[model samples]
Target chain A: AQSVTQPDIHITVSEGASLELRCNYSYGATPYLFWYVQSPGQGLQLLLKYFSGDTLVQGIKGFEAEFKRSQSSFNLRKPSVHWSDAAEYFCARIDSGYSTLTFGKGTMLLVSP
Target chain B: DVKVTQSSRYLVKRTGEKVFLECVQDMDHENMFWYRQDPGLGLRLIYFSYDVKMKEKGDIPEGYSVSREKKERFSLILESASTNQTSMYLCASSGGQAYSNQPQHFGDGTRLSIL
Candidate 1:
């Protein structure tokens, strides 16, 4: 079965610091990868997605992700994090056959002042 | 912009009672999905509909049923609400070819609590 793994369960970073959240997937071939963020009491919002294109894809909220086929990883990165960036981040991949998503357990980002 | 609207923001019900959660989409999307969000589980798919009156079971569909009588409306039914069923339910919709990769638009979510 195809699955997404987010190694870090919780990450605390100082405001204005760089941020990176790691994600790895188990699949034979390159798949459609996505990053989503959810704030407290709110549903998820799409951050970025990677399909058949350049390895790097930019998304809303000044975020971007790189899809590394060799590593089977699609990691999210931001140069400077803000206090408002504190939220839960999920990594997901489209199940090509079913058009459904398989999401990771999620990484909770806490931006400290 | 695609707008997915969930009927309630929060709801409380007793065990064994039937529960109905409503979802509507304005973009006339071809796909609608139901998922439950938990602390460690991230999001688990419950059910989905590709078209009107067509339903399919998802990863976790036990104890849940779905109805998509109209293209714009998809409802999730809990036959017997239980305490373990208390969760944050999310509804999402996506347009375009079923086989193509499309980002799903999500609602604000409904936090359902069963007593």
Candidate 2:
């Protein structure tokens, strides 16, 4: 079975600082990867996705993620994170056979002024 | 934009009572899914339907049943509500192709409490 792992449980970063959230997946083959953000009391919104093309995929809200096949990892990065970027981040991979998504435990991001 | 609407934002029901949570999508998607979210645990799939009257069990299907009489609407039913079932329920929809790599659209979610 495919699984996603997010190592950090909570991360606090100062505003305007660079941000990177780690994600690792265990799968036999290259699977579609995605990043999603969820604000308090709201549903999750897609940040970005990696299908096949370039390893580096850009997403909404000035965010981007790079897929590294060798490490079996896809990490999300932002040059400068705003206060509004504080939320719970989740990394997911598409189930090869079922077309469903398997998500990570999630990392809570806190922006400090 | 794809719109997935869950009927209630919050619901309170008594233990052992029958509970129903409704979801509807406007994108005419062929795949609809139900998941539960809890602290320290990410979303866990409860059930999913690819077509009307076609339902598949997800990772956690115990004490839960689903109904998909219409293509756009999917309902999750709790046979007998329990406090352990108190959690946030989310609904999602995806494209028609079963194996296609389409992203799923999510709703605001319904917070259900069984007391």
Candidate 3:
């Protein structure tokens, strides 16, 4: 079964500081990775995705993730984060085709001034 | 922009009562899905519809049923609502190509409470 693990359950970061959220996925074949953000009382928005070709994938709102094949990790990173960046982040994976995706429990990001 | 709309933002129902949660998409997406969101559980798929009148049971579908009479609307039904079923229900839609892994666009979600 394809699964995703987000190590950090909660992370607190100061505003304008760099941010990185760790994600590990388990899949037999090539994996499609994705990052999504959810605001309180709102639906999820896609941050980025990794299919093939590029190891480094850029997403919306100044976010990027690198897909590491050997380590089975696709961590999201941002050089600088704003206070509005505080939200719950989820990492998901799916095998080839339009199948269902398995998501991590999510990491809550807290930004402080 | 794709817009997935759920009929209600919040709903309150009594135990053993029949409940219906409606979802509609404006993008004419061929794939519509229903998922329940809970703390620690993240999101669990309840049902999925690939096309009109075609439905598939997802990871968790024991307490729920679905209807997809039209291409743009998919409905989730609870035969007998239970307190355990109280959670945030989200609706999403995606383009249904065989090998395309398009991201699913989500709705605002419906928070259902069962008494």
Residue-level lDDT of model 2, residues A36-109, one tens digit each, is: 99999888898999989999999999999999999999999999999999999999999556678899999999
**Which wins on lDDT, candidate 2 or candidate 3?**
2
> Across residues B1-115, which tens digit of lDDT does each residue of candidate 1 receive?
8899999999999999999999999998999999999888789999998999999899999999999999999999999999999999999999876755798889999999999
Model 1: per-residue Cα lDDT at residue B18:
100
Greater lDDT among 1 and 3 belongs to 1
Q: What share of the true interface contacts does candidate 3 keep?
A: 0.62
Candidate 2 clashing pairs, residues 3+ apart or interchain: none
TM-score of chain B of 2: 0.98
Model 3: how far residue A73 lies from native, Å? 0.6
lDDT of 3 by residue, B4-72 (tens): 999999999999999999999999898889999999899999999888998888999998999999999
Provide the global lDDT of candidate 1 against the true structure: 0.94
Candidate 1, A2-113: lDDT as tens digits? 9999999999999999999999999746588999999999989999999877999999999999999889999999999999999999999986665888899999999999
Q: What lDDT does the true structure give each of the candidates?
A: 0.94, 0.93, 0.92
How do the residues B1-115 of candidate 2 rate in per-residue lDDT, one tens digit apiece?
A: 9999999999999999999999999999999999999999899999998888999999999999999999999999999999999999999999857766689889999999999
- Model 2 scores a C-alpha lDDT of 0.93
Worst 10 residues of 3 chain A by lDDT: A93-102
Best by DockQ: 1
